[model samples]
Structure formats: structure tokens, C-alpha cells
Target: MSNEDQYGGGVGSGYGEVGGTGQTRTRLPDAPSDPYGTPRRAPRASRGLVTVVGVVVLLIAAIAFANQSSDSPRTPADQTPPAATSTSATGTRPVDGKNGAIPKGFAHDEQGAQSAAANYAVALVSADILKPQMRRQIVRQVFVADKVSELEARLDQAYGKTFLDQAGLDANGNAAQGLTYISRTVPVGTKAAKNSESTTTVDVWCTGVFGTAGVGSTNPVSNDWFTMTLTLRWAENDWKVESFAQKDGPAPVHTDRTASTAEEIAKAATEFGGFTYAR
Candidate 1:
């Protein structure tokens, strides 16, 4: 299927001052000697003095608190920004096995979603997807149960006889004997959005090469740029496509570099290996 291009404190003190005069001191006679006399006890501290001491203690405590705050370790949110996760490879490893040739067992996290989306993009745009048996296998492997039958029917219609003829493939979706047909997508980057434990939507931005490569081939290999978005569900400990779509691009301007010969392009496409992408 050409499904390739969809869219202050104060203390107070009182002091008595005594002055000496030249006059002789006079003592008044006691009014009457009392049988019993009790001296008044000294007064407790004044309210102002107590208030000033309380303020000083509080100031000391506040200063100590400020110091401790400065020395405390920062929480995760306060550390240096997590090293640019987008476009940069992450530490999480890709799945170790395959379901036939398809990657199996992606991590059940955002990174897993991204990896699944990327690998699925490669498979979807690959030449194998054009063949009926492989296409059926791919649909069943990548898509969820609810979507498999519908997607299978739609894809079969899309890759029908007419499309095969235009692509120079035979009724069985095979390129003629001498020419090498190439349809491969390499993911440049991937993004995950609306990711939760059970569901995520991932976008894979890709650059692909398509068409047959040979001296007399009518369809010379050409480059296309597109983005594929896959909505995934976490099922049986792996991320599986619930649905997906393709759109034209966030493509860059064409470069002025010289193009390679058809033979070289075909050889490279066959020889080079693809990747198992992570977030």
C-alpha cells in the first residue's frame, strides 16, 4: 500500500540619680516603731525586657533555619534539567527478541512506546509489507485485536492489483527478477505523548527510500519524508499498535549533494543494517 503519505527590640531600664548637696543631712524621726515590719520583695523582670529577649531568641532561630535551608539537598525537580531526552538516545535497552522479524517485548514505558512506534514505522514502510502473506503477518503482529481485521481489509484493498502494477511488482507483489526493489524507512526521531501506564501515542519521524533500482527500471529509487503516529496499548507486557496514521512531513529542504548511481543505491539498501530505536 502507498499508505506512505496521510496526513526592632528594645529594653528599658530606670535608674535613680543621687546628687550631693552642701547642706547637712536631716533624718526624720520614725513615725512609730512597728511591732512587726515586712520588707517588700523585689519586682520581677519588666514586660519590655521579656519582650526584647523573646525577639532576640526568635531572630537567632530564623537565622539558623535559613542556614539549614541553604545546605539541604535538592529534590529531583530542583536538579539540572534531565539531559535533553528528545532526539538523544536513552539508556533503556531495546527488546531482545523478535516476533518473526518484528521486534518483540518493548518496555512498558514512554521509551517502550517510542521504540515500538519507530520499529513499526520501519516495518510498515518496508517492501515486505507489500506481499500478501507478510502483510497479513505484520498486521496481526503489530496491531491490536480490535483493529487487526479492519486494518487487514483496508490494507489489502490499498495494495491491490492496480497498485502492484504501478509499483512494477507482479501479481504476487514481487519485483521482476533482475531489479532490486527498495522500500525502507529509518526513524530520525520519535516522540511519545499522552503516555500513561496503559496507553500512549507515539510519533515516528522518518526518511525513506522507495522504488526499484536497476539500469532499465522505470521507477528509480527516490526519497520521501513522512511522520507516522501510532497509538499503542500496553498488552501482554508489550506495546502494540491500537491504530496508526501517516502524514507528509516535517521535511527539511532538499540538499545539493550529488546523488548516487542506481546500482550503488540498491547495493547500499541491501547491505546496510537498520536499528532498534529507543527514546
Candidate 2:
């Protein structure tokens, strides 16, 4: 079955355009205009324009809400000097059940490293890095010397012909007309599974939507769960992803939102861009 069939469609939202009933009318003027046309009257604004404006407003409001809801910028409470009960020196910690696995960047010293791992994982699986040339560049920049060649070869094979075909793309990985290819990992949380002065083992558990959403598309957007275990060697002031692996879900309960039409999903995917995660 396709991703849509398995996950019930689209990423956070499902497939299918939302439909609503609206009245249409033809207005008749009292009299015909002269040759000059009495200075052509301005047409009334379209319902579509009104809808677009409303959507923009809502999006702004939503973003504002999210920002306000974020934790304060001051030093995190966990960063305060540890109490007698505290077992770890670095107070920064991951919340239980936030992500499926342990968090990253617990020690105050390793926050940068943890951020690097999270960002690297985001880059690794992003649709942007799927292109062979780009993937190579990313691997070279982010991976350690020992693993670059092996990872490059493996990723090339993994994103090979069969994978493209399954994703409804050509060997080059471009989406067919009217289709949007989606492959992005959003870090749900990060934690330090193990740590030391020189090396830190961080786990970044992510939930993402991947696949294609389009009319008559074979691969539709769907949800996926994966944990990325990263071993970092404090290198050049950043925590680079020394190695990583993926294991499927501890998925959450589903919501009752209506699925959107394939067309809508495709449009949204195209219109919106993904983000670069940070710790």
C-alpha cells in the first residue's frame, strides 16, 4: 500500500482539498455604458482574495502564538546549579515522553555539540540533500573522515533507482508534474544517552512526513517515526554526526481532522518550505 493508504494521507494534515459551499451571482447594472464606458467601474474583491488574506492573518497569529508559548530565553531552569538530588553536572535535560528516545546536549558544555547533531540529522534526511551532488557535499562537511566514503556510497545506493521509482520520481529524483516530493525529519526532542568530557552519545528521536502528494500520485505523504543515534567527538567547536541509524515508530494517537484533497496537499507542500532545526 502507498504511504497515504497506510497513514491516511498527507503530513500533519491529510490529503484532499477542503470543500465548502459559497453562493455565486451575476449583478446587472441599471443601464448600458456610453462609448467612453463611464470610466470602467472597479470590480469587487474576489472571494478567493478574501480567503487568501484570511489565511495569511491566521498564519501570522499562529506563529505569534507559538513563539509566545516557547520557553523563556533566559537560562533554562535545569541550567541552574544542580541540587543534592541531581546526578549530572549539566542540568539541561530532556523531558520524558517528549521524543521516543533519550535527549541530547545535557552537559552545558555539549549544547553546541547536541545542536550540531540535531541540525546534521535534519540535513541528512531532508529532501534537499537527496540529490547526489548535494548529498556528497553535505556528507563531506558534516561527517568525520573515516565514515565519509562509506556513508556516501551507502546513501547513493539507498537513494538509487529503485527508491526513486518507489517515490514516483525519475532516477534524478525530480517529482513528476503536479506532484510534490516530501522527505523531512523534525526532531521531536534530543537527549544525552551517554556522555563524557570527550565523547557524547545523543539520541534524536524524530517524527516526519515523507513521500509524494499529488493527483494520481502513487506515493502519497505519510507519517514516519525514527530515532537517530549520534556519537559526537567534540570537533572544531561543533558536534558533528559521527554516525546515525533509523528505527521506526512509537507513533502517537491520531487526530480527527478531515483529509484534504491530493491537490491541496500538493499545493501546500510546494508553497511551504521546511526548517533547519537547532538545539
Clashing pairs in 2: 15-260, 16-260, 16-261, 17-260, 17-261, 103-190, 103-191, 103-192, 104-190, 104-191
**TM-score winner among the candidates?**
1
Instruction: State the lDDT of candidate 1 residue by residue for 190-265, as single tens digits.
Output: 8765589998866667666655677776555556554555567887778887654334457788777877887999
How displaced is residue 275 in candidate 1, in Å? Answer: 2.0
Give the range where candidate 2 is weakest over 10 consecutive residues by summed lDDT: 20-29
**Per-residue accuracy of model 2 over 28-119 as CA lDDT, tens digit each:** 00011100000001111233334323322222222111111111111212445645533323344422221112123323355655655566
Q: After superposition, how far is residue 135 of candidate 1 from its true place, in Å?
A: 0.5
Which 10 consecutive positions of candidate 1 have the poorest summed lDDT? Answer: 15-24
Q: Please state the error at residue 6 of candidate 2 in Å.
A: 13
**lDDT score at residue 37, model 2, on the 0-100 scale:** 5
TM-score versus the correct structure, for each prediction: 0.69, 0.59
Off by over 4 Å in 2: 1-108
As a whole number from 0 to 100, the lDDT of residue 206 in candidate 2 is 63
Judged by lDDT, which candidate is best? 1
